[model samples]
Target: MTSVGTQEKTRPCPRCGAGIGGDERFTVWCAACDWNVDPEGPRKEPRRLDRTRRALARRHGEKLHAGIVSGEDLRARRDASALLALVIALAVHGVTAAVAALGIWCLVHGWGGWPMLPGLFLLLLAWVLRPRPASLPDHVPVLHRAAAPTLFALVDEVAEVAGTRGVDAIVIDGAVNASVQAYGMRGRRMLVLGMPYWEILTPQQRVALLGHELGHYGNGDVRHHTVLGSAYASLITWWYCFAPEDDPAATALELISNLLLLVPYWLVTGVLLLLDRLTLRASQRAEYLADRTSAHVGSTEAAVGLTDRMLVTDSVEAVLAREANRAALAGPSGYRAAGDRADELWERLTSHMASIPEAEYERQRRVGALRGHSVDATHPPTHLRRAGLIAGERMPAAVVVEGDRADRIAAELAGARRLVGRRIILDGPSFGG
Candidate 1:
C-alpha cells in the first residue's frame, strides 16, 4: 500500500490548486491554501454510506430532470411518509401497551412473580414510543406591526401576490440569512429577517427574498416539513430511550442484552436515514419552486441577483468578522467602534461585487459546484440555480415596490438595524463581557 504522505502528494488541495502533504496524523493542513482537514471530522461519513447517498441523489436528480416526478408528487410522497411514520409509532405504542396490560392482568390473577419485570419494561416502552409535541423557540424577540408597519406592509404585499397566509409575526436577527418558521399548535407563521442580509439587498431584491420565504407556505413546504420533522424527532426519542449504554459487557446476560438492543438501534436508525433521503429531494424541489415564485412575484433578475449575492456575502462576512475582532482588541473602547467598522465593511464589500467581471464571477461560483451534490441538502447548489435561470426563458418584470414607498420601508428598518447590531456586538466574538 502507498504511504499516507505519498498519497497526499498525489492529491491537490481543495481550496488552492497545490499538492498536499500528509502525515500519519488524523488532521492534515494545506500550507498553500491554509486549508485544514480532519479525517475524523463530522463531515466524514463512511464510504459505503456515502456511496448509497450518492446513488439516491443521482436517482432523484434523474427523475427530477426527466419530469417523472412533479412538485405535487414529491409533496404527496412526503405526506405519505409522514403518515407511515405516524402509523408505525402508533403500532409500536399499541403493542407495548397491550403487553403492559397483559402483565397487569396476570398480576391481578395472582401470577405476579417475574411477570412484574416484563410489565414494567413494557410500560416503559409504551411511554418511550409516545409522540411528542413540536417545540417553539423561547425568548425570541417578535416584531409587532405597530413598531414596523412599513415592513409588515411589504410582507403583506408579498404574501398576497404569492397566495400565502399573512405572516403572524416578524423577527429581526443578527445572522446573514433569512427564513420562515411555523410555531405553536396552530402553526402560526413567523418571518425571520437577518438585518445583515437585509442591509445588503435593494428593495427589489428584498421583495424577492420575501417572496421566496412566503412561497414555502404557498407550496405547503412548511406544513410538510413540520409533520415530517416531528415524526423523525419522535423516532429519535424512542431510539434514545432504549439505546445501549457505552459500557463493556461483563456478563453473558449483559452481552446478550446489548446485542439485542443493537437490532432496534440499527432498525430505527435505518428508518431515520431512509426518511431523510426521501424528504431531501422534496426539499430541494421546493427550493426551486420557491425561486420560481420569487421570480413571479418580483423580477427574475432580482431573484437571480439575490442568489448570487448570497454566495458572495458568506465570504464578506468571514473577512469582516475577523476585522471586527481585531478592532475590538486594539483598545479599551474598541467594541463600539468595531460595530461601526462592520457596517462599513459590509457596505464596501457589497458595492464592490458589481465591479467584478461576469466571467470571473461565474468562475467563482463553479467552486461550489465542485463540492459534489448534496444528498440531504435543504437547497440546491447556488450555481445550478443560477445556470437554470440563465438558460430559461426571460420573465416579465414585476416590480412590487418602487419610489418613495420602498424608501419609506427602508427608512423604517433603520431602528431595527441598530437593535440587530447591538445584539450582534453583545453576542459577537468582539465582545469580551
Candidate 2:
C-alpha cells in the first residue's frame, strides 16, 4: 500500500549521526540532536561599516529583550539617547535652513552679476538638500476607505484598541510582510498588507499584525518621526555628495577631487554613524512596545502565533519558489491563467503554512537564537520576541473578527488578492517592495 510519493529519503547527520528525513530537493537536519540547524549561519555583511552597525544592533537588541523578559516596561521614555538624537536632528535641519538662506541672500544681493552663477549653484544645492516628506509608494494599488469599508472597519477597531487613529489608505502588495508608515508632511498614516503573508495568517493574527503596525504611531520611535527621519535623509545626501567613486584607474583631476573631498566625506560619515548609534536603542524599544500592543489588542495567544508565523516567512517564500519552479519545468501546460492562479494560491499557501511541523518550528527557534536572526537591523530577534510575549502579561482580545465579518473582509480584498497573486506567479516574489 506504500506509495513512492509517500517515501522519505533518510540520511545520517554528519555531526550527531541521528536520522534525518526529507525529500531529495529539501534540506534535512537532525531535530533530536539539533545538528545541521542554521548550517549557513548569519549572513555576512560585505561593508565594514554595515558589519559594525549590525553587530552593535544585535548586542543591544539582545540586552533589550532580556530587560523586557525581566519585567521592564515596554513603553519608551525620553531617554538620554533619544534626546541627543533629537538635538542632532534639529542641528541637521538648522544646516539645511542656513544653506537656503545663504542661497536666497546671494540671489537678492547680486541679481545681475557674476555672483548670480554661484547663487544659482547654491540654490540648487539647497534644493537637493531639502528634507523629503514621506509619500505613498507607486508599486502597489491603494484601497480607499470607501472601497474597502469592511477591512477598514476591522483596522479601525484594532486602531482603537491600540490607542491610535487608523490609516488613511491600505496598500495591498505581493511581499510577505506588513507595515504601517506615515505619508506626507501632515503624517497621515498608511497601512500596507502583503497578501502572501496575510493569506497564511489566522483571522486573529491579522488583528495582531494591525495592532503592531498602528502601535508605531504612539511608540515614541524618534527615528520614524518626520523631523528625525528627514534629517537622516539629509545626512545621507551629504554623504553621497562627498563620497568618492570606486574607480581603480583615475585621471589626475579625479584624484585631486577625491583628496579635496576626503575631509568633508569623513565628517559626514562620522555624523551619520553617530546619529544611527544614538537612535538605535530607542528604535528597538519601540519595537518591543509595538509587540506588546499586538498582544494587548489580539490576546497573547494570537500574538504569539503571529510571531511564530514571522519566523517562518522564508518558508512561505520557499513554497512560492517551488510552485514557480514546477511551472517552469512543466512548460506551457503547467501555466495557469492569472485568474485561476490567483483564486487557488491563497488556499495552497494556507494549507502549506498550516501543515508546517511542530518540530520544524522548534528547530527554527533554536536557529534564531544561534544566529541572532532579526527581521532587520531595527527589530529584535524572533526567538526573543516570542519569549518576551510568552513571559509578558496576557489579556483578553480587545478586538475580535467574527466569522461573518472575516468573510466580508475577505470579499473586499478579492481584487487585491488576485493582483498580488498574479504578481507572484509572473514575477516570483517581490519581498519588501
Candidate 3:
C-alpha cells in the first residue's frame, strides 16, 4: 500500500529531485506537472477467518523515536540479538530432537547417543557462529583512495559530532537518490550518498541528509522494518507454497493460524496504509532527528542551512539528464507509456481499482501494482514523492519545518490516503518490528 499519512526518510525528489522535508500528503503533486497528490489508499483488511478464529494483526512498525541509537550500545546490541536468535533457533531444534530421541528410542530399544550427537553439534555451532558486530575496516578502497582513512574517518567524524558511531558503508549507486539498508544485528547497512546527491548539496546540507538517514538506522527503525518485513515475506511465501495443498474445507482454527502465517505483512501494511501517516510521519520525525544529530555534531545553523541548500534543484536535473543519453537505447516509443497495449493495461488497472472499496488497502494495492512490486506491496509511488517536496514549498510553514525537533514540524500529514500517477495509497509501515 502507498503511504498517505506516514513519513518517508527524506530523499531528494525522484521527479523534481528536490531535497525538502515536511508532511503534507495531499498537497504534494506529481513531478510531471502540478497534479494533486494522488491518494494512495483505502487500506486493505487482512484476509478474514470465521467468527470463531482468534488472531490479532501483526504490529505495524511505525513508532517514532527521538535522538539516535548510541554507537557503542548499538554494536553491543547487534551482537547480542544475533547471538540470541541463533541460540533460540538452535536450542529449539536440539531440544525437540533430543527429547524425541531420548523418549522414542529408549522406549523402542536401548539408549543411544547417535541422534543426540548432531544436536550437540548444532548447539555448539549456534554459540560459535552467533552474530558479531562488524567494525569499520581500517583499509580503504581504490574508489575511496583519494579520501583514504579520511573516507571512513569522515563517517566517524560526523558520527562523533552527532554522538553516534560511524556509518556502515559509503556506496556509490548510479541513482541520484540514496537509502540506508541497515543490516547485521545493530550496525547499519547504509546505501549512503551517491555522487549525484553529494554533488548537489553544500557540505553542511549533505551532513543534514546524512543525519536524517542515520536517525532511522540508529533508532533501530531500519532493523525493525527489515526483520519484520523479512519474516512477513517468509510467511507469505509459506502461504503461497502451501495454498494448493491445504484442504479447501480446513477448520476455522487451522485457517486462522495459517492465515496468520501468510497475511500479516499485507494486513499490517493495510492498517498503517489506511492510517497513512507512517512514512511521511516517520520520515519527518527521522529528518528531525538527523537535524538534531547534525546540529549536535556541528551547529544547528549548518543543519538547517544544509537542508536549504540541498533543496536546490539544478543537480537533480543534471542527474536526470543522463537518462536522455540513453534515448538511442530506448526502443521505438522508448518505453511503455505511449502504446495501445500500455493504454489498455492502464485502463484495466484503473477499472480494477474502481471496483475496490474506497479504502487505504485498496489504494496501496493499486499503487504497488503500478510500482511493479506485489499487487499489494507496501510502498508509496515515486511520483507522489516528487509532489511532497513541492507541497512543502507551497506551505509557508514549510520553510522552517521542524522534524525530530522539539518544535512544530510545519504541517501535520494529510489524512493517510495519498495519490500519484493513477495510484493513490500509503507506503506500508515497516512489516516487522
Give the root-mean-square deviation of each candidate in angstroms: 9.3, 3.3, 16.3
Model 1: lDDT of residue 427: 48
Best model per lDDT = 2
Clashing pairs in 1: none
Locate the minimum summed-lDDT window of 10 residues in model 2.
1-10
Q: Over the stretch 74-173, how does candidate 1's per-residue lDDT look in tens digits?
A: 3323457545655654555565567667757655654547766776666565566544453344434467788778878888888888888778788776
Between 2 and 3, whose TM-score is larger?
A: 2
Q: How close is candidate 2 to the true structure, as a TM-score?
A: 0.88
Tens digit per residue, CA lDDT, model 3, 1-433 = 3334456345465567665333333134343332222454334444442110111111111122211221111111233434444344344345435544554544345336565565555445444333334333332111232333444554555555444566556544323444565445664554435433444444445555565555555644422354333433333342343342267888888777677655644553443332222233333343434444555443455454444433322224332343333222455544333232323322333333333222323233234334322111332222222222322212111112124421211011111011111111111111110
TM-score attained by model 1: 0.67
CA RMSD (A), model 1: 9.3
For candidate 3, the C-alpha RMSD (Å) to the true structure equals 16.3
Each model's total of backbone clashes: 0, 0, 50
